[model samples]
Target: MKLKLRIWRQSSADAKGRMVSYELDDVSEDASFLEMLDVLNERLIAEGDDPVAFDHDCREGICGACSLVIDGQPHGPQAATTTCQLHMRKFKDGDSIDIEPWRAGAFPVIKDLVVDRSAFDRIIQAGGYISAPTGTAPDAHAVPIPKQDADAAFSAAACIGCGACVAACPNGSGMLFMGAKVAHLGLTPQGQPERATRVLGMVAAHDEAGFGGCTNTGECAAACPKEIGLDVIGRLNADFRKAAIRAA
Candidate 1:
């Protein structure tokens, strides 16, 4: 298949960016989106031109590194799909595709399609873990977490922190990502001890990192590759309110 790509090009964080167009022929329908880019880079490199840069790892979609907005959709037009898992077949011949990095102030582009997502790491460090030590792996039935709570916790934990939530949000809020981390722990009995502090610290870090506040537009959950629900954000807000009151 033949295709046209309009990609954002920026050499550095401070460099100006613009869409540059290129055309390619003989693309395989089975080729994953990243593989298509690889083909384009190969041709550019063979001509001594700087290859387009994009983030990718574990192309099977486990790693959220393949962050991109394809044709105005995060991870292409497919619902609940990551860019690495998107296929050329999803497009038609002669289609013009616009590829851009995750657009959010908290996730500034480092170059080409890569953005600095260390803001997520900072939020995690703030309080995404249970500091209480479990010296060794416990018996499978030791804690006996309610199946309902366990399922909810597992669902929340599915979040891959891809920043698609932020990219899709009109306000650039990361509440979906932040809420997932909070709910993942909060739903589990082991996470109770730090529940209050976890919500407080993470929310503080989230704001400090320049992420916007959630306003219930629901775009974050819709764009989530993991299908993390806006319900997690509700849980986050509930926890935050309780935490704030407790602190007072």
Candidate 2:
């Protein structure tokens, strides 16, 4: 397959960026999207031209480091798919693809497709972790968590913090990410002690990081590669309300 790519190129966060066009011929349809970019970079290096910079630790979908908006969609057209997992076959021969880094105030571009996502780390630091230790590996039957709650917690824990939810939101909100972080633990037995504080702290950090407020438009869930749902947001809101009322 052959394709035309319009990619965003920026040298640094302080530098301005623009879409630069390049073409690839005889590309394999079975190749992952990142593999196609690798081919492009290899070709550029062979020509002694600067290579396109993009983020990818694991070629598999686990890392979520491959953050690229394809054709105005975060992680491309496929639902519940990451950019790294996107294959060339998703597009056709002679297709023109638009590729850009995540566009959000909190996720400012560093170089090319790389954005500084450390804001998410700081938000996690605010309250995402449980400070309490379980001491030793407890027996499997020790906690006896309800099946429904356990399932919900596992679903919430599936969040990879890819920031797609934030990138896709028109308001640039991180509420879905925050909701997943808060709800995963809030539903677990080990997370009971810090439930109120966890939600309060993470939500506060989310705002301090310059993330826009969520208006419940539901775009976040649609773009989520992990398929994290909107119910977590409701849980977050309810937790925050109770926490605030208790403080009053």
Candidate 3:
């Protein structure tokens, strides 16, 4: 198949960016999106042109490092799919594809299709972990957790921190991301002790990192590659309210 790509090119964070078009011919329909880019980069190198830059760690879609806004949709037009998991077959021959990095004040452009997502790491560091004692390995059956709580925690833990939620939100909100982090731990026994403080700190860090506030538009949940639900956000709000009232 042949394809036309209109990709955003920025030399650096301080530099201006524009869409640069390139025509790709004989691209295999079954090739992964990143693989198609690899082919494009090889061609560019042969032509003595700078190759397009994008992030991809573990290209298996587990790492969430392959971030791309394809054709005005985060991770392409598919629901519950990351860019790395997207296949070229999703597009038709002679289709023009628009590719850009995640757009948000918190996620600054590094170069080409790569963006600095360390803001997410900062939010995680703020208190997204539990304070469990580290000693000898405890048996998995040592602590008996209720089935419902375990399921909820597992569901929330499915989030991969891909930033699709923020990219899809009109306000650039990170609520679904933050909510998943909060709920994943809050529903578990090991995470109970730090639940209140963790929610408070992560939310504060999210705001400090310049992530916009959640407006309940629900776009975040819709764009989530993992299909993490907005119910996590609802749970997070309740937890935050409880924390605030307790602090007062």
Candidate 4:
């Protein structure tokens, strides 16, 4: 396959960026998107040109590190897939692809296709952890969780901390991500100790990270690679309301 890539090239966080076009030929349909970028970087190096920079790790899609907006889609046109899992065959033989980074104030572009996502790390540190003592795991039967709640919590826990949810949001809200973090733990008995504080701290950190508020447009859930539902956001709101009232 042959592809024309219009990539956003930025040298540093404060540097100017623009879409630069390049052409690739002999691209294998089986190549993952990051693999295709590797080919392009190889060619650029051989030509004495600076290679494009992009984020990627664990290309099997578990890491959620490979982030790219292909042709206006957060992770290409595919639904429920990350950029690392996207294949070249998804495109036509002579397709024009727009490769860019996650566009959000909270996720500023560092260079080419890499963005500084440390803000997400900060959000997690605010309240995404349980206060369990470091020790051996409790017996499986110690505190049996209902299957329904366990399933819901597991689904919310599927979130990979990818910023696609924010990137796809018109308001650049981290609501989906924050909500997932809240729900996964809030649904369980173990999460009860810090339930009220968790919502407050996470929401505060989310806003401090420059993430905008959600307007219930549902774009975040739609763009989520894990398919985390907007229902998680509803849970987050309810928890926040109850927490705020109790604090009062």
Candidate 5:
């Protein structure tokens, strides 16, 4: 396939950025999106031009590091697919693709398509884990957790922290991501001890990191590659209310 790519280019975090256009040809229909970009970069390098910089760790889509907004969509046109998994066949010949990094204050661009997502790491540090000694891995049936709770926890744990939720939200909120972490741990027995404090601390850290408040727009879930449901946000709110009341 022959394609035109209009990609965002920023020399540094403080540097001004703009869209630069390049023509890519001979892209295989089976090639993943990142592979297509790799072809483009090789051409530029061979031509003595600076290559486009984009984030990508695991091309298998498990890492969530391939954070690109393609043609105004967080991950691309496909539903529940990350940029790394999006195939060249999804586009037709002579297509013009616009690619940009996650646009949110909390995720400032470092250079080209890379953004500093360390804010997510900070939020996790605030309360995303059970600091208590877990001792050792217990038998699967040892802990008597309700099947429903276990399912919900597993669903919420699918969140990959890609920042797509924040990018898709009109208010630039990270509630869905934060809520997933909260629900994932709160529903599990191992996380019960820190449930209340976890919600409180994480919420505090989320706000401190400059993420906007969620207004229930549901864009986050729609853009989520893992399909994390909006119910986790409700659970987060409930837990926060109880935590606030207890601290009062």
Candidate 6:
């Protein structure tokens, strides 16, 4: 398949960015999005041109590092799929694809198609962890977590912190990401000890990172590659309320 890519190119964070067009011929339909880019970069290098820069690791969709806004959608037109998992078959021959980085204040562009996502790491570090003692592994069934809570926690834990939620939101909210982190621990017995503090700390960190507040627009969940539900946001709100009241 052939494609025309209109990709954003910026020399640095302070550099002005604009779309630069390139044509690719003989691209395999089976090529994953990042693989196609590899082909393109190889061609650019052979031609003595500066290759486009993008992020990718564990292209099986586990890493969430291959962030791309394709054709105006956060990971292309697919639902519940990350850019690394997106295939070239999604586009037709001669298609013009527009690619950009995640656009949010919290995710400032470092260069072409690469943004600094350390804000997410900061938010997680703020409190997205259990306060359990450091020791040898405990027995799986030692604390008997209810099946429902276990399932909910697993669902929330599916989030990969891709920042697509913020890119897709009109307000650029990190609520969905924050909510998933909170719910992942809040529903588990090992997390209960720090539940109150975790929610408060993570939410505050999210705000401090320049992410906007949640308005219940549901765009975050819709654009989420993991299909993590807005219900996690509700859980986050409830947990935050409880934490605030206790602190009062």
Model 3, stretches more than 4 Å misplaced?
none
Error of 2 at 108 (Å): 0.5
lDDT of 1 at 68: 95
Query: Total clashes, candidate 6?
Result: 0
Model 5: residues with Cα > 4 Å off, grouped in runs? none
* Steric collisions counted per model: 0, 0, 0, 0, 0, 0
92-153, model 2: which lDDT tens digit per residue?
99999999999999999999999999889988999998876556887888998899999999
lDDT string for model 4 (62-93, tens) is 78787888888899899999999989989999
Candidate 4: residue 108 Cα off by (Å): 0.8
Model 6's TM-score against the true structure = 0.98
lDDT of 5: 0.94
TM-score of each: 0.99, 0.98, 0.98, 0.98, 0.98, 0.98
Model 3 TM-score? 0.98
Give per-residue CA lDDT, model 1, range 151-218, as digits (tens). 99999999988999999999999999999999999999899999999999999999999999889999
Give candidate 2's TM-score. 0.98
Task: Write one digit per residue (lDDT tens) for candidate 6, span 25-136.
Answer: 9999999999999999999999999999998999988888989999889998989999999998888998999999999999999999999999999998999887767889
CA shift at 130, candidate 1, in angstroms? 0.5
RMSD of each: 0.7, 0.9, 0.7, 0.7, 0.9, 0.8
State each model's CA lDDT, in order. Answer: 0.94, 0.92, 0.93, 0.93, 0.94, 0.93
Q: Over all chains combined, what TM-score does candidate 5 have?
A: 0.98
What would the per-residue lDDT of candidate 3 be over residues 146-216, giving only the tens digit for each residue? 99999999999999999999998998889999999999999988998988999999999999999999989
